[model samples]
Target: MIELRDAAYDYGGGGLALRGLDLSLAPGSFHFLTGPSGAGKTTLLKLLYGELRPTGGAALLFGSDTRAMDRDGVSDARRRIGVVHQDCRFLDHLPVHDNVALPLRVAGGDVASRADDVAQLLGWVGLGARMHARPPELSGGERQRAALARALVMDPDVLIADEPTGNVDWDMSQRLLTLLAELNRMGKAVIVATHDLALIRAAKAQVAARVLRLSGGALSAAGADL
Candidate 1:
């Protein structure tokens, strides 16, 4: 559902993020993006989610060229994709339920009608009792799940998570991975960008994962070990 052809992103002032990167992700496919710091993993994820347009070449989402898409077009395209960032931020004053439902609210949906649905989603991510709590009150893992719940709240066609397991412990990480695996099984394409090889290994054991490593502003299939 996503493709990048000869994509190059220049950060300006002698820095380039991506260079001639050619990548494609099939619908319902599960993949891991791995690389060292500043290797363009996050840049690549931004490209997929329409947060960044390639400086050269084409970056396509579900057949729509990102460079050619207008603001409304980009927003519409992003509605089909969900992203979990490394540092998930939420309004500290808002309750967890409200924070998770912010996207729907921003999209001008009927909040009352979607209240129960958002609550159930919070419960799914193990935040049922914490629904009334503010974001600052949540623990690290709780915040992570809250972010995941928020991402899935849109029921997106494609899920892109950047360093999802970064803040959680091993067991919690496994639980989050399992949840993502289940989503992939349910036919939602998932792309995760992470530096943890162990997490990738764990995920690969549960699903047929296609792993890619970004290096020197380029992307390629990861070797067997990673």
Candidate 2:
């Protein structure tokens, strides 16, 4: 679990990207983070995952203050959290299966022993047939799904997705949402940062999520209008 208590972050000359934020992500919790351009959603996500420690307040991951964590501490905490970045950062030279297996490999996991799990995860994301395709050969939706598969291959306790459905069509967006919802049902905490209101509404029928809005370097609960 992660908790931020009056967390604030400033990027030197970039001014304050986030400030006075308090958030607690417990087991089985689901949250949707929404905001406009330059609103610091990505910065907040980075803080949550321990990529950036808060400059003025506490940002804790798995019970330890991120500011106090060493590199190995950060890596250990990150291994428990899976993040699907906005750009779907994949190595074009690697096939989808290998790309999905990269995290396990980096974590010193037995890739050979988990081959079947990797295949099953790709299939779950609807990319079974495209497992051998390289990143450059995939469609936008396919790439997103593949990214999700990669994020999940580690079986992390939390999943954080940034604009996960931004490049896909409505149907594909729904498909991805359904997959996320299923994961939530299985007890993983889910945090999705998206600007898509319709997608948020659609998620209403599938899972219980607290919608949050970030603006002017602060965070607030979204109104019922969402």
- Top candidate (lDDT): 2
Model 2, 196-220: lDDT tens digits are 9999999999999999999999999
**Runs in model 2 with CA error above 4 Å?**
none
The whole-model C-alpha lDDT of candidate 1 against the native structure comes to 0.88
lDDT over C-alpha atoms for residue 57 of model 1: 91
- RMSD per candidate (Å) reads 1.1, 0.9
lDDT (10s digit) by residue, model 1, range 42-89: 888899888999999999988999999999898977877878888887
For residue 114, model 1's alpha carbon misses the true position, in angstroms, by 1.3
- Model 1: weakest 10-residue lDDT segment is 16-25
Please give me the total number of clashing residue pairs in predicted model 1: 0
With candidate 1 superimposed using the best TM-score fit, by how many Å does residue 122's alpha carbon deviate from the native? 1.1
Tell me the deviation in Å of residue 213 in model 2.
0.3
Error of 2 at 43 (Å): 0.4
TM-score for candidate 2, residues paired by index: 0.98
